[model samples]
Target chain A: DDEVITHAHGAGGGQMTELVDAVAVSQFADAAADVGLAALDDGSVQPIDDDHSVVVTTDSHVVTPLFFRGGDIGRLAVSGTVNDLAMMGATEPLALTSSLIIEAGTPQTTVERVTESMREACEEAGATVTTGDTKVMGSGEMDTLAINTTGVAVVPKGGHVPDAGLSVGDRLIVSGTVGDHGISLLSEREGFDFGGDLESDVQPVNDLVRAAMDAGEVTAMKDPTRGGLATVLNEMASKADVGIDVEERSVPVSGPVSSAGEVLGIEPFDVACEGVVVMGVASEDAADVLDALRDNPKGEDAAIVGEVVDDHTGQVVLDTGFGRRYLSPPEGEQLPRIC
Target chain B: DDEVITHAHGAGGGQMTELVDAVAVSQFADAAADVGLAALDDGSVQPIDDDHSVVVTTDSHVVTPLFFRGGDIGRLAVSGTVNDLAMMGATEPLALTSSLIIEAGTPQTTVERVTESMREACEEAGATVTTGDTKVMGSGEMDTLAINTTGVAVVPKGGHVPDAGLSVGDRLIVSGTVGDHGISLLSEREGFDFGGDLESDVQPVNDLVRAAMDAGEVTAMKDPTRGGLATVLNEMASKADVGIDVEERSVPVSGPVSSAGEVLGIEPFDVACEGVVVMGVASEDAADVLDALRDNPKGEDAAIVGEVVDDHTGQVVLDTGFGRRYLSPPEGEQLPRIC
Candidate 1:
C-alpha cells in the first residue's frame, strides 16, 4: 500500500477494497454481526431476536458544488443510505440519523436548502430523519459541507437479501438507465452543457425496489452507485463464485448521457447511477419481476440486461452482438465528488 | 440569523440551539420517534416491540490536530456515540457504524492509528464497529480527517432516560472532575506545558454509568461535552421546567485542572469534560448512586453537585457561600475544533 492515502483509495474500486480490508476489516475482525465488516456488502445485519434482525448502513457524502441539476447533497445523503438498506431487503427504514459538518463561512441559506432537500427526500422514501448532529469547522479547515447519514431498518430473520446469493441460472435486472448521475455531474462540472436532458438521476429508489421484491424473489441485490454497472456486475459474479453474461445493448443509457460520456471520454457503464438497482432474480420469476419494476415510474426503463452462468466463473462477460469481453471493476474514480 | 454560519452557530450554546431548531427540528418535525429530533436529546428511541425499544445516536468529530493528549479523534469518535447511547440508558450498544472522510494527502499510518484507537475503545465499551464508509477529499479541500460514528442499542420499552426527566427534589451527581478535556486541549494547542496530569479524560465511561444505573434510579442524564457542565445543567433545568441549585464547592475539580483553568481565565463548569456524566437521581438513591460510581476507577472523583428545586423555574443557581449567582451557558465556542 502507498504510504499516503490517495483519491483512488476512496473511489469504490479495487484499491478501496484493499484499503478497507486492511484498515477496517482486519481491526474489526471480532464484530458479532451476521453480515458485518468482513462481508463488504451494502450494510451489516444483526439479529435482534428469533424473528427479526436489524440492518444498518452509513455513508458520508462530500459531494462538491453541494447542489446540482437534479438533486443536492442533502438528498444524496438520505437516498444513499436508504438505497443501501433497500439493497439488503430492508426497504422501509425505521429512521435515519443525519450528521452535518459545515465550513464556518457556509451561507445559512445553503444549510436551509440542504435541510429542505433532505426532508423532501425522506418524504419520498417514506423514511424520517429522527436525530442528527451539527458541527462547523474553521473556514479553510473544511470544504463547503459534508453530510453523513446512517439508516436503520428491521427485517424478518433469514429474509434479507445478500449480494452473494446468486444461483447459476439467476437473471439480472436493472431498474433504470445507467451512468446518468456520474455523467451528468461530470458534464456540469466541466462546463459542458448537454442541454437540460443531461441531468443527474439522483432520487430514492426504495419504492421501485419494493415493487420488484414484492413481485418475485430477488436472489441478490446491489445499487450501482460509486462504481457503476460494470463494477457491480463484476462484484456479484466474483462474490457468488459464478459468471455473469450481459447483453451490452440491453443496458439502457439515456441519449444525453451517452452523448455526454463520449464528449467527456468516459464510459457510461464505468461510472455511477445513484437512482438504480441491479438485482439477480430467481430464473422462474424473472419476467414477473421485470414487469413489476417497469410498472413503477422510477423504473420505467427497467430491463433484463444479464444472467448468471456457470462457465467462466468469477467473471463478467459482456456481449456486444459482434464480440464478447470480460468486464472489470473500475480502477479509480472518474469524477471526484460526483456522489 | 446571520447571512453566513459562524463558529458560534456550532458551539453547542444559544446560537447553536437556534440554528438546529430552525434548520433540523423544523424540517424533521414529522419524525415518528418516541424521543425524536424535537426533543434534542442525546439520542432517539423507537419502540421495536412490546418489550423492547431501539435507541440510536450519532456524532461527527472534527477536532483539530487529530491527536490530542489522552485521546485522538478515533477514541473520541467511538466513545462519543457510545456514551450518548449510555446516557439514554442503553448501556450496551449492539453495533456502531463509522464513516471516515480524509484529505487526499493524509498518511495511511494516521488512519491506521485512528482505526486502532477506535478498536480499543470499542473493546472497552463492549461494542463493535460493524460497518463503515471511507472517502477522500482533494488536498487543501479538507483538514486531515473527520469521523462520524452512529450507535444503535436496544433496551426495554420505556426504560430509557431523557435529559428532561428531572424532578423538583431530584439530586444531581457528576461522575468525575470537570474541564479536563477542553482545558487540556487548549493548553496543548497553545504550546503551554500543563504537565501530563492535565491530559484529557476521554475514555469511555459506559461501564461506570452502568454501575450507577444498577445501583439507583436515575431520572435524567447527560454528558458534558461541547458546552460543558453549565450547558447540560441549564438544558436539564429548562427542559424539565424546574430549577437546579448547586453548591459550587461540591463540584469536583482536580488540582491540575483547577490551576490551569484559573490561569486561563476559564470556568471549569463552562468547559467540556468528555468522560463525565451528570445525572439527576431520586433523592433517596443519591448516596447509593454516588457510592456505585466511586467504586469505578473512572468515577473515583464522583460527587453530589446539586439538587433540583421548585423555585426559579428553568434556571440554575450557584451557591458560593459568600454570594450566589446564576450559571449561564457558555456564550460561544471557547475553542474551535475542540470536539
Candidate 2:
C-alpha cells in the first residue's frame, strides 16, 4: 500500500482497487470465511432463509455539483445501490435506507428537488426508501451534499451471479453507451461547454438485468461505475483468472461522447458509466442475450463487446482494425469523484 | 421550512427531527405505504420470513477529529449502526456494509488503524462487514474522513420494541452513564482538559440490548444519540402519546462527565451518547429488568431514571430535589458533528 492515499486511489481505477484491497478489505479477517464477501461483486449476498437470500449493497455519493444534466446525487445514490444488487443477480429489489449529510446553507429547494428525483428513481427500480437519516454540517465542513444509500434485495436461493464466475470462451457484453456519465459530469465540473447533446446516462438497470437473466445463464455481472468499462473487465479477468479480448469497433460509444473524451484528453474506456452493466455469458448464448438486452429501453444499444479467452490470462487485450494492443487499467484517479 | 439548512438540523435534536420530517421524510411518498418505514424507530425493519424479520439501519459518522481518546470513527461507525439495530429489538446482528469517503492524501496508516478498529468492533458485536465501497475525493473536496455503515440484523417474530409501545404505567430505564460520548468529544474539540479521567463511552451495545430484551418485555427502546436522553424520552412520549417524569437524582451521571458538561455550558441531556439505551418497561417488570441489566458489565450502572405517567401528555417532567420542572427537547446544534 502507498504511504498516503491519492486522488487516483478513489478514482474507481486500478489504484482504487489496490487501496481497497490493502486498506479496507485487508482488515476484515472473516470476509473470506464463507460469508459471501470473498466474491467482491458490486454487492454482497447472504442467506436469510432456506429458500431465499438477501442482497445488500451500499455506496456513498460525494459527486460534485449534485445536479447534472440528466440526474442528481439523490438519483445516483438510489440507482447505484440498486444496480449493485442487480449485478449480484438480484431479481427483485426490496427496501432501501438513505442517509444524507448536508452542508449548512444548502438551499432547501435543492434538497427537495434531489429527494423527489430519488423517489422517482426508486419507483423506477421497484424499490422504496423504507428508512433514512439526515445530518447537516457547518458550511465549509462538507461539500454541498453527500448521500449514502443501502439497498436490500431478495433473490431465490442460489440464483445470484458471482464476480469470479467468468470462464474461458465466455462472451462479454456492454449494456449500452460507455463513458456518458463520466464525460457529462467532467464537462460540468470543469465548466466545459461541449455545447452538444451530452447528458449522463445514469438510471436504474434492474429491468435490463432481469431481461438478461431471463434470456440465458449469466455467469458473471458488473456495473462499470468508478472504473469504467476497462477497469471492470480487468477486475473480472483478474478475479476469475481469464483473459478478455474486445473488438475496438464493436464497443458501443456515442459519437458525441467519444468526441468529448477526445477533446478532454481522456480515453473513453477510462471514464465511468452510471447506468451500464458488463456481463459474461456462455459463448453459445451470446446472441440470445444480446437480443434480449436489445428489447429493453435501457439496453437498446447493448452489444457483445468482447469475449473471455485463455491466452493472456488475468489480462485484457484490445483488437484494433490492423493490430492488437494490451488494455491496462488506468493508474490513478483519472476522473476524481465522478460517481 | 427554512430556505437554508443549518447545523442544528443535523444535531439529532429537535431541529434535526423537524428538518428530517420536513425535507427527507416528506419526500419519501411511500415510506408509510406498508413498506415498514413508518414506525420511525432507530431502524426500519422488514419481514424476511414467516418466523423472522430483518432490521436495517444506516448512519454517517462525521465527527470533527477522526480519532478520540476512547474510540475512533471506525469503532463509532460500527457501534453506532449495531446499536441502532439493537434498539430496534434485533438480538442477533448478522451482517454490515461499510462505505468510506476519504479525502485525497489521507494517511494509509490511519486508514488501516480505523479499519482495524472497525473489525474489532464488528467482532465484539457478533457481526461482520460482508461488503463495502470506498470513494476518494479531492484533497479539499471533503473533510478528513467520513464513514457510513449500514447493518442488517435478524430478530424473532414479535420480539422488537416499537417506539409507540409506551403506556401510562410503564417505567423508563437508562442503561448506563449518559453524556460521556458527547461531553468527551466536545471537550477534545474545544481544547479543554480538566486533567481528570474522561473518555467517550463508545462501544458496541448489542449485548446490553440483548440482555435487556431477555430480562423482560421492553415496551419501547431507543439510544440517546444526537438528541440525548431528554430528547429521546420526549420522542417516545410524543410518538406514544404518554407523559414521562424523570427523577434527577436517579439518573446516573459520572462525576467527571457531569462536571465536564457543566463547564462546557452544555446540558447532559442535549448532547449525544454512543453506547447507551433507554427502555420503557412495564411497571411490574421493572425490578427484574434492573436486576438483569445490573448483572451485565455494560449495564452495571443501569437505573430506573423515569416513568411513563398520565399527566403532561407528550412531554417530559424532570423532578429536582426541590421541585419539578419541565424538560424540553434541545432546540438546535448542541455540539456540531459530535457523532
Error of 1 at B195 (Å): 2.8
User: What TM-score does each model's chain B reach against the true chain B?
Assistant: 0.98, 0.96
TM-score for each model: 0.99, 0.97
- The residue-by-residue lDDT of candidate 1 on B125-214, one tens digit each, is 999998999999999999999999999999999999999999999999999999999999888888887677788899888899999999
Candidate 2 lDDT by residue in tens digits, A1-339: 458888877777666667778755676655422226656778887777677677888899988778888889988998998999899998567678888988899988788788889889988998888788887778877788889999887678788888778999899999999999999888878788787568899999999999998898899998988878888888999999999999989999998888889988888887889999999999888999999999998899899988999889888999987899988877755877787
Per-candidate Cα RMSD to the true structure, in Å, reads: 1.0, 1.8
| Candidate 2 lDDT for residue B246 | 95
Q: Sum up the clashes in candidate 2.
A: 1
Runs in model 1 lying further than 4 Å from the true structure: none
The lDDT leader among the candidates is 1
